[model samples]
Target chain A: MSIAWYLAVSGIVFSLGAFGVMTRRNPLVVLLCLELMLNGANLALIAFSRMWGNGDGQILALVVMTVAACEVCIGLGMIVAIYRRRLPINVDELRELQG
Target chain B: MSTVLFFLAASGVISGAVGVVVLRNPFYSVLALVAHLVSLAVLFLLLRAEFVAAVQVVVYAGAVMVLYVFVVAYVGGESDSVGERLRGAGGTGSSGSSLRLGGAILAGALLVELLIALLGTGLEAIGGYGAPYSPGPQSFGTPAYIGKLLLTRFLLAFEMASFLLLIAAVGGVVLARRRGGLGEEDERDLLTPLDLMRPRETGTMAEGVGGRTP
Candidate 1:
């Protein structure tokens, strides 16, 4: 298969993630969507890494994975904290930060 | 064979991504994400990035997914009830529905645009169909190769990532520790009242704790 097939799949995955992030009220779901987006980007990066015949993109994917780990950890912690506090889990309702 | 493998991985990726979105429960979303990540790992293998593929499976599918499932269980299904309740109460009202529609439309448009751009540009430069598999040097994507690159060219980034992970650990710990104390009950919780709706408004938290906090 050509690299375009991978890129196209990546794009579709990314768009699905974006839709989820935009529509989902649950912070956890949003976080999952964010993961999707990150992976979609990583797929493309790995593809390009193959095309250019280098390990740079693979290494970049590693760093991105680390960042994703951190983001998800903190995000889930916040969600748990929010739930513990009796706060609504809906992001729309948790607009205390709205300015 | 490679094309079939690529298609299989691609289908998994696309289907998993959709499942993550379409599934209502966060637990299911986590599962879908795991599938997605694992399929992505397969794709990485196709790309000849063996090490990254392995790490993707271990880190994303194994570790991160465990955390997600744990949180989903801890928070319980009630975590998602807030949305339905708000919708039932007409809390967000038409704006909420419109926002949902708008978001879906915008996302679809974005996908179309991305596909167009990718098909137009991304297809031309890279490998064409039926390209033979040419696995790169044996050293490629090995932990050793990546480690060397990290230490030499990306040394600063590597250190910073470790630092960031440390910070994230501390932050998660700080965020998780109850405001009152480890074992102590709140003598008026210093947290949870930031909402304009008063902590009692939703009545969602455990019966006694929220009432006592204020």
Candidate 2:
């Protein structure tokens, strides 16, 4: 449809993701929220690419996807480590060193 | 009709995204996130970004989320008191919440501004960018353009991404294998708490006095 509608949807999704990361204590949830934010950006980029008749934005979206994949790879590792250290994967309990 | 379809798809995406945020259980959040990804893919399709939409489904909803699900199940149950712990942790106090909300607003505003600026300039004429590119929606949406562009122009970045993934894989394995490896626990030790839930067979049926006394 219209580009404005896509942007608006992206904005709402990104805001929800931001709120999730801010409020949720679980690292896994935080990662999921981060994915939402990235996906929101991806949507906006594709919409812009379509409107502007350029492939640049689409290419950038591809780069973002690659980055997102890498992020998940590492984030999942961290989650597993957190689970190991505390026997429970809670972000609040993850603090091992705090001065 | 296209506009209506786009709106419906966008709303579906937004709802799933909100579910990802509002759900308490991480497992459900991941599932909702997958739903969100699928809806976004549909939005991409509506925008005529067929290649992008296909990649979105296969890469995100197919591969990435499966990794998430496995990780979540492997992590298993977490402490239900995590919220209380965070409240006491002194990290994301009330101020943090406000700042995060503000950050979200700021991001949204910036995105709006960008879109507005781009829109004011209006859509640039197609096939006018130096050379006449492929014609038709399908031609533009083919992976060939993307493939050549990424390989010839963005080759270095692609290599770097490969390196990053390599590191991530190694790190995940190392991190998962480190301390509390679960190797020391025997069947009996692991079953300590779970074993308590099982009901044992009674030696005599008559002991319960259901039919007759022994």
Candidate 3:
């Protein structure tokens, strides 16, 4: 198929992830949706790499993976801390920082 | 052959994404995410990103997802506290749940925007359909080439990524550890300024935030 086809699929996946982020109240689910968004971008990178015929996109995609790991690490750490504190896990409940 | 396989992987990817969003329980949603990640790996492979594909399975599916599982299990196994709170306060179509509705509309708008941008410019500059998949250098997707590029061309970035991992490890440990500094008297984390200012007599926490008079 065309690289455009791949790009289209990537866009759809990304939108789904965004929808999840918007709707889900659970922080864990939000993080999962974030992963889905990143994967969507990764798909585009690999598709373009195939089209342009280079490894740069693949390399960048690897970097994205590393960044995603770091993100999940910190986010989960925060969630655990919140749980430990007896705070409500609902994102709606925890608005201490809201101005 | 490749096209057929691509469609199959595409179906898996789309379905898994839907599952992650629609599954009410996060445990099931996490499982759905796993399916999505694996399908993504297959797509990576079809794109000839051999190294990335393998790493996607191992790092994402094996390592990162496991970490998520551990945290979710730890938080969840104790009680379904998170789930309960989510459903009670933020169930679909609830008055305060307009964010979901807005998000749905915005997501659709974004998809439309992206499709228009894509379709207008087109991928014709390079090959779109039936573009000859040219295998560049033999070492393209091999770890050796990537490693070489990492050590040579992208040395600083590679080192920084390693350092980033170290920082994340330390941050995780520090943030998650219990500190008994705050006692029952200090319920500061529970009370936002808005909550305290709104008069304790009226409105729940969610309502207090939204109905602020400022």
Candidate 4:
């Protein structure tokens, strides 16, 4: 497969993810969409890594994975705290931080 | 063979992503996310990043997804109404429809721009970045090669990542626990050690015991 094909696929997925983030109200779903975007970037990175004949891109991908894991840990923790405070998790209800 | 697999995995990734966005149920959305992750791993394999692909499955599909499913099942309310709110009127009152339309337009524009850029660049331009179709050595993306690079070149980054994970674990625990400390009510609300050991039963203990007697 051509590198262009991979890039195109990555772009499509990233756009879809951006759409999800914009349209979805649920915080968890929004977080999932963010994961989609991250995965799209990872795909592009791997494609470039393959093309470059270098291990750097793959290493960067591994770092991305670690960061993604940490994001999930902290994100879900916050979600749980929110659920406890409000009984239901809704992004629309979280207006306290609005300044 | 590789091209066919790439198309199949790409389709799987796209459809699963759409399902995640379009599905009303959070459970199904999570399932779709799992499908997307697995197929992305397949794509990584096709790209010859075997170690990364394996880590994708183990970390994303295995650990992170399990955490998501647990939170969805245990903590999340059965708010089908939330999904309806998302689909019905966009939930922001007078600005709802406009927001939806605006978001759609924005995303479409982004997709178009990306497609144009990719196509306009020409395949030869991208091909000139490196060796193009050459898969490098047999050990290029293997675990051994990755491990060597991690230990030697990327040692600081790898160590920092480990520290980050440790902090994440500690922060998650601290955040999830009640702030007032383990009071009587908090203790009652929290899952006990015995609760962890026992299988989760649907009805009252009396009902469970009575049913078992029969």
TM-score of chain A of each: 0.96, 0.90, 0.95, 0.93
Off by over 4 Å in 3: B77-93, B125-137, B181-214
Question: Cα lDDT for residue B142, model 3?
Answer: 73
Tens-digit lDDT track of model 1 for B1-214 = 9989988988998999999998877888889888888888998888778889989988789988999999889888556655666576976577867988999999999999988877787345565642234545546666777878899999898999999999999999988777865665674465655555554546545655557554
DockQ of each: 0.58, 0.36, 0.46, 0.59
Candidate with the larger TM-score of 2 and 3: 3
Lowest lDDT sum, 10 consecutive residues, model 3 chain A, at: A90-99
Instruction: List, residue by residue over B132-190, the lDDT tens digit for candidate 2.
Output: 33566345556876677678888887688778778878876776676744566474464
TM-score of 1: 0.83
* Fnat for candidate 2 (0 to 1): 0.47
Candidate 4 deviant stretches above 4 angstroms: B83-94, B122-138, B185-214
List ranges where model 1 is wrong by over 4 Å: B89-95, B122-124, B127-137, B183-214
Each model's number of backbone clashes?
0, 0, 0, 0
Q: Name the candidate that leads on DockQ.
A: 4
Clash pairs of candidate 3? none
TM-score of 3: 0.81
TM-score of each: 0.83, 0.73, 0.81, 0.83
Of the candidates shown, which would achieve the greatest TM-score relative to the real structure? 1
DockQ leaderboard ranking: 4, 1, 3, 2
Docking class of 3: acceptable
Q: For candidate 3, what is the interface RMSD? A: 2.0
